[model samples]
Target: MTLDQFEARAREFLESRCSRRGPVATEWGSGEERLALFHETTDEQERAEAEAALAWQRERWAAGFGWITGPVEHGGAGLSAEHDRRYREIEAEFDVPDMAPLRIGLGTVSHALLAAGTPEQIATHAVPLHRGEAVACQLFSEPEAGSDLAGVRTRGVRDGDTWRVDGQKVWTSNATFADIGLALIRTDPDAPKHRGLSMFLVPMNTPGIEVRPLRQMTGGASFCEVFLSDVRLDDALRLGEPGSGWKVATSALAGERRAVGDRSHEMNARAMALLATLAQRTGRADDPAVRDAWVSLHSRLQIARFQQQRMQATDERTLTGAERAIDKVLLAANYKLIGDLAAELLGPAFVADTGEWGTFNWNRWLMGSMGYRIAGGTEEILKTMLAERVLGLPREPQEMKR
Candidate 1:
């Protein structure tokens, strides 16, 4: 179908489920506007939002618009990526619930499953995730293995049909409410660090699983530390062949980097727009330094956009690991740059939570900026990848012996 036809169908589908709303106009100095980097929702509020989003997704899935670019056998439309992009364009104009909470499920976990899951596993999990009947989280990062994912020490010992898992994962987003977790565990400790790992689809409600929220500087407990103590999983839950988890994790990490990069561009644009409005509100729009900063930010945004388009156009099979790392590096740096400019614009107000709404709220963006740098991959790690892999530089030497 043509783009217009697809959009019309999407519009019709969305209108049937939710009210049609035009793009929200940004009003200068409106304290009611949301400018937080991370949502500071209470547990009740987060649950409500997640439920509403899931319902909307299920409705969309029922109408054949949930997974536009997903494979046909997996309850998706099996259309081109452009078709999916068009649907998103149409979605933005509606007053539907935000789908941020479902990103890891749909973007990362689903991709990982598709790459390495068995046919039965795919049939079981894909539809539920696409329909938003279930949510998933990544259990890759650990306390000692944040950037060095290959160094994870989570262990899973095989016992007949089940594996007893015991490990701790930190910075696990959505664990508090996830139905399933895509976990990496050391199944073959005798093998090399990278090769001994394996991936599994673990039920979050398993008896030995525990989730503890970690409150951030932005006053949001969106990140959590997950403890798996003797969590038992049937061998059927394993995603890929034993010792093949590194490959599965690489695929998921690629998806994660792309998702993070896309979100960074979007959030950076919104934050910059808000900064422009703040300048106008404070009568600093025409100031030379402000104009320079605006121009610089716009230039950087354009560069980031170009990089994003390049990444999107390249087929996933043909894209190199360094190329994947570049998008995230640009994205994280761009977000930090935008946050710095906002601080320069607001001065003291950026730091203090004054009675002002939009002004003080920028603290959310600034505080949350650091987390983005570390989320997909740390700046230092990505830079090293670019250097060694992309630029043909030698790998950094291991740290000197203590």
Candidate 2:
């Protein structure tokens, strides 16, 4: 179909659901402070957001818009990637419900499963995820294995037809609400760390699994710590060959980095607009030093925006895995920089809540920005990967774990 036809079809579908978004309110001391990097939601509020997002996704699935670029045999529209991009561009014009809750399932989990799952697994688990019938979360990080994924200590011992899992996963997003978890476990202790691991799909409601929310300094429980004790799963739940866990885990991490970059531009743009207003209101707009910092940040952010647009237009096959790290690192640094700018603008007021409109409320954003640096992948780790993989530098010596 023609691009115009595609636009018309998407517009018709969106118009039936919601009206176009009006101009954003940018006035100082107006509306919400909204500076938090992570969502600050009560339990009730979180559930409401989830329900609204799921409802919208289910409708999109029924109308063949949920999985635009997904395969036809897997319950998707089987359209081109361009069609998917165009639909999202059009969808942005309308006031649709936020789909942040479904991002892990759609962006990270589904990509990894599609790459490594069997046909039956794809149809059973991946399809429901794309259709928004169920939510999935990755269970990769452990207390000691945050960035060093190969060091994951979660154990899985085989029985007759089931594997007994026992380990703890930290920093798992959406675990409290996820229906399924893609868990990485050590299946063979005698093999090398990377080779001994395996991936599995565990039903979240399994008998011996527990999810406890981890509250951040920003007072948001966006991540969870999960414990699995004697959790048993059928062999069919295994994602790939016993020793291919590294391959399957990296697939999801790559998707996560790209997704992080894709979603960051808009958030950064909004912060820039708000910070510009903050500067003028606080009389720092005319300061030469403030101006210099603002310009530098602005230039870097604008370049990052252009880089992302170029990537979106380019073919995925032409890109390298190292390219994904660039966006993640760029945005992560920008988030901290923006937080610093906010702190400078607010000055001493940034330390205390004085009931001022936009002053002290920015504390959440600054604290939360630091989390992004460690999320997706740590800054130190990604930079090393870029140096060795992208720049052809000498590899860093790995400390032998004997």
TM-score of 1: 0.94
lDDT of 2 by residue, 187-302 (tens): 99999899999999999999999999999888888888999999999999999999899889888888888778887876788788889999998899999989999999999998
Residue 313 shift from truth in candidate 1, angstroms: 3.0
**Candidate 2 stretches greater than 4 Å from native:** 400-402
Question: How many steric clashes between backbone atoms does each model show?
Answer: 0, 0
All candidates' lDDT scores?
0.84, 0.87
Error of 1 at 235 (Å): 0.9
lDDT tens digits by residue: candidate 1, 1-402: 787888888888888877877545566655466666677888778888889889988888889988988888877888877787668767877788888888899889998988998778988986789987998899999999998999999999999999999999999888889899999999999997899999999999999999999988878888899999999899999999999999999899898988777656556666777888888878889999989988987998898889888877666778766787888887777777787888888889887877776777777776777887898888898898899888899989988867
Q: Give each model a TM-score.
A: 0.94, 0.97
lDDT of 1: 0.84
Taking all chains together, the TM-score of candidate 2 against the true structure is 0.97
